[model samples]
Target: MVVTRFAPSPNGSLHLGHAFSAIAAHDIAQERGGRFLLRIEDIDGERSMPEKAAEFRKDLAWLGLEWEEVPAQSTRLANYEEAAQYLLHEGLLYPCTCTRKDIAARNPRMGPEGAVYPGTCKGQSLDPDKPAALRLDVDRAMAGLGELSWEDEVGGTQIADPRPFGDVVLVRKDAPASYHLAATLDDAADGVTLVTRGEDLFSSTHVHRVLQELLGLPVPTWHHHPILLDEEDEKLAKRRCSPSLADRRAAGEDGRALARQLRMGEFPAGITQSNA
Candidate 1:
């Protein structure tokens, strides 16, 4: 059966963009008579508000979307550690002690995500006691895996090239695992066959494909749908303080009606669709 998931971080409230993504995933599964799963990405340490996860459930329920709740990221730390150990054993990962400021000081070339790491500590053996993040050796990981590609629902087949991201971090210094590591593992563990999310994360699939190949995990087809944008043409984001679904719910708005409107491409006054 086709399985899709709407994984949301519990760091903030779900906004229109998030609701749209969730409804898209839920509809995909429902239309196919498949399973729609909800996975709470609550691994942001203290920044993760556990209460927000309950609110997410309420919002989804309010939208008349049903989903099977899966093990959250917090409960899957051991799986992340195991995968990290496997990669470390394969010599595909390295410990880096470089800070954001240190990388910015070097004026590193920007990549899809941001300023790519310039391999400052590539071969250096820094103090082991110092806290460090585990970075994937992109070059080493993609050595034999030539011409990797993944299927996208809208964009068709995509060539996977993670070199531009440099050595991406798998395990952060503060967090147990990065989104790349955890999300890939979580999808595989939950038996998800169709990964759905906004188009902004399209580039992330490159890095995720590499991780799947290295970890010998099953590759799922992806659907990077258009994301909602505000009046300024910026994507609706929590950091931008976009209006949240909870606020609308508290106003006694009809969530199902709103979902239907969103499905029909009927956005609110100031919201518009932006292509990826």
Candidate 2:
């Protein structure tokens, strides 16, 4: 069966960006006869507040999107740890103690996201008691991946070289799995087959693909969609809260009003009673 997800971090409220993703994933589920899941990507304990998660849930429900159940990252920590260990056991992961300054000093040129990790301490001996983040060996995976291309729902076919992402951090020193690691694991665990999110995340797919291969999971097909940008053409951050969902609901926002604002343009949507 086809399964898709809108895995949002509960670090902030649902804004225009959230609604765009919610509708995109929901519409895809409808089209594929699939389940549209809502997974909380709150791996960072410091950031995830109970009230924020509650508010995020209410906001999505108010927007006419529903899910199977709430599977939180903190509760699913064991699974992430097990996955990390498995990668370590397979020699796909290595510990690095390089600080941010060390990384930039080694490689000044950065990719789209930021400075490509220089792999300074990649092969260096480290104290067992010292803290370290688990990093995926990109070159090893790249040898298997080569040049890859994915189909985007909005932007058409895309090709990636995979050199820029370099080695991505899978697990932080504190054992909180990075978003790339946790999302791939949760998506596979939830049996997510089609991933629908903003185009801005397209670059991150290289990291996800590498981990999927390292972990022996079948990589899901990607459909990176258009982002809802602001007047300055910057990626909209929920902190602005200009056309806030809460404000909209207070002003009587419902499915139709949301659709119009989101440019989803009314094709019949609801909090449908489905397996999702």
Candidate 3:
């Protein structure tokens, strides 16, 4: 059976952008006569609160989005760990301990070099007892990816040469598995054959695609749809920037209203309602 999923981090409440992606994935999978699953991305221990995760699920249910039951990503680290170890054993990953400053110095064009990472420790060693993140050997993975393209139902065919990303961190220096790692593993584990997400994550597909090849897992069909922006025309965040989804829902904004607003080709406002 074909499978698809709407996996979200439990760091914040579901927002209008999230609602758009969720509806698209669920509706597409249903139309294709496939299964739609929900996986709580609770990998970030510090920010992932049980209450917040509950609010995400509650909000989705209220919006009438259904899913096949699984506990959550926090409960499923065993799967990710096993996959990471498989890659490690296959020599697909290396240990990295580069600091933010070290990475920024290497690639100025790299966005927010603080996060782009120079892969300083790709071949170096640290105290075995000291903490470190696992970095993927991207050049090797690129050689593995070769030239492959997938057509999206909504976004169109996306192509890229996966040679420049360099070795990226699979595990964060301070966190276990980063979003790309966990997400790739989650899709593989759940037998997902289709993936529909926000266009903001379009570049993220390269990272996931590499991981999928390195793990000997099948890469699913990808559809990166447009995001629903707020009045500020900015991506939604739970931080000082965007309002929380729970707050919006409590104010009585519904998904139907959001869909209509976006379909009408409305641009988000320059200034949004103040959360503070």
Could you tally the backbone clashes for each prediction?
Answer: 0, 0, 1
Model 2: weakest 10-residue lDDT segment is 267-276
Candidate 1, poorest ten consecutive residues by summed lDDT: 120-129
Q: Please report how far candidate 3 places residue 250 from its true position, in Å.
A: 2.3
What TM-score would each prediction reach against the true structure?
A: 0.98, 0.86, 0.84
Q: Give the residue spans of candidate 3 off by over 4 A.
A: 111-115, 253-276
Q: What is the lDDT for 87 in model 3?
A: 78
Model 1: per-residue lDDT, tens digit, 1-276? 999999999999999999999999999999999999999999998999999999999999989899999989999999999999998888888889999999999999999889999998776543568899999989988898988889999999999999999999999999999999999999999999999999999999999998999889999999999999999999999999999999999999999999999999999999999962
Candidate 1 stretches greater than 4 Å from native? 125-128
lDDT of each: 0.94, 0.73, 0.71
How well is each residue in 113-166 modelled by candidate 2, as lDDT tens digits? 798887766765436798888887777767766676665566667675566877
Top lDDT hit: 1
Order by TM-score, highest first:
1, 2, 3
Q: Candidate 2 — number of clashing residue pairs?
A: 0
**RMSD (Å) per prediction:** 1.2, 5.6, 4.0
lDDT (tens digit, per residue) of candidate 3 on 151-170:
56666776754445567778
**CA lDDT, candidate 1, residue 180:** 93
